[model samples]
Target: MELGTSLEKRKVPNMLKRILQYDVQLTKKFVDLALRTTTLKSLRNHAKLFEVSCHGIVWLACWLSFIWLFNNKELYQLQVNMFIALILDIVVIAVIKAFVRRRRPVPMNKLMELGPDKFSFPSGHTSRAVLVAFILICLNPISIIFYPPLLAWVTAVSISRVLQERHYLLDVVCGAGVGLLEGLFMALIWFSQSASASILSSLSDEKLDGGEYHV
Candidate 1:
């Protein structure tokens, strides 16, 4: 339940009752395995849905957008901030990939192996997508409702990475973790800067008052 916890080993109490929506003990017990299998299989099948949640692509698009509007030179401040967030997310992802140094899930393996590459664990797509989704929601609360499709898109992307034989599930999940850390780091920086500015402003106001008294 903690923030950034791996989706694995994420147990659900009363799985049959909750998933199947039948609280009857006998029926629940009877259908537990079926329900569990059905739910997991369905989710894995749809893992492709979360593919778009990749940080690299999302940040690259954001970078392109920034460049596209660069000539205007009057872009909204929010765009600037998003640009910074994108950059930060990317750097964090790269650093994490290097540190983790995991292997791809068996390339071309019938069950796994989609895209084979050097980096694995913590899906970069997942992390970036989640970060973008968070920022978008912060800028406009309404965007939160759209998180489902976005999350699905990101998950699909993660699945695609597997299908393409690039990354394993763990790699994708780890990418998501790095992204979360990046977002949190950005938020803390913004808040700290804002607080410092406020304190400086107060000090300035006090100095002005002392000057006026002397005058």
Candidate 2:
């Protein structure tokens, strides 16, 4: 019985190792196929456009600047919550990437590499895309007519990560899941207009005029 127990414990680790190896091999095969197929290659090239659109730094900077400059009462709640959510997304992605330390499918140029950017287990762009889409759609930030485009953007961003050989299939999949969870978490702890205003007030010298704002 003791020998059987020992063998079972050893087999568990071997099983996990095999699963990880299979994942890597499968991702390599898919990336190679994408490179060889003309249609896929073109799609990958186009997908690069979407990748640039969802860059984390750009989104954060734009949102932060908007929050500081515009300060429109109509968009106060969304702007604040979204800005905070973006920060939350960045922190979560950075923590996970640091913990996983998974290498990208291709080595990034040293000049472009940033902290946590070298890891590939979860695509930061994918997560950010998903989080933004979820907020825009579920939160009804804009007219419902924009839902389709928002969803399409998220889908494109997620697929582009894999097609561009920036991440494994599992990485994109897990990223979407993470983004969805972050959206739900933000919803649960959603800041009220007053809460958002107070937080923003503390950060900036801006004072809200005596007016009611609705989300």
> Best by lDDT, which number?
2
Task: Point out where model 1 deviates above 4 Å.
Answer: 1-58, 70-75, 109-117, 139-145, 163-165, 191-215
lDDT of 1: 0.54
TM-score (C-alpha) between model 2 and the true structure: 0.80
lDDT of 1 at 90: 67
**CA RMSD (A), model 2:** 6.6
Tell me the TM-score of each prediction against the true structure.
0.52, 0.80
lDDT value, candidate 2, whole model:
0.80
lDDT of 1 by residue, 98-181 (tens): 765555544333665345346765566767776766666654234466878766665566545544445544455566677667
Candidate 2 runs further than 4 Å off = 1-12, 36-39, 107-116, 207-215
Q: Write the per-residue lDDT of candidate 2 for residues 94-159, one digit (tens) a residue.
A: 999987777787623244323446789788898999999888878637788888888888887887
Q: For candidate 2, list the clashing residue pairs, or say none.
A: none
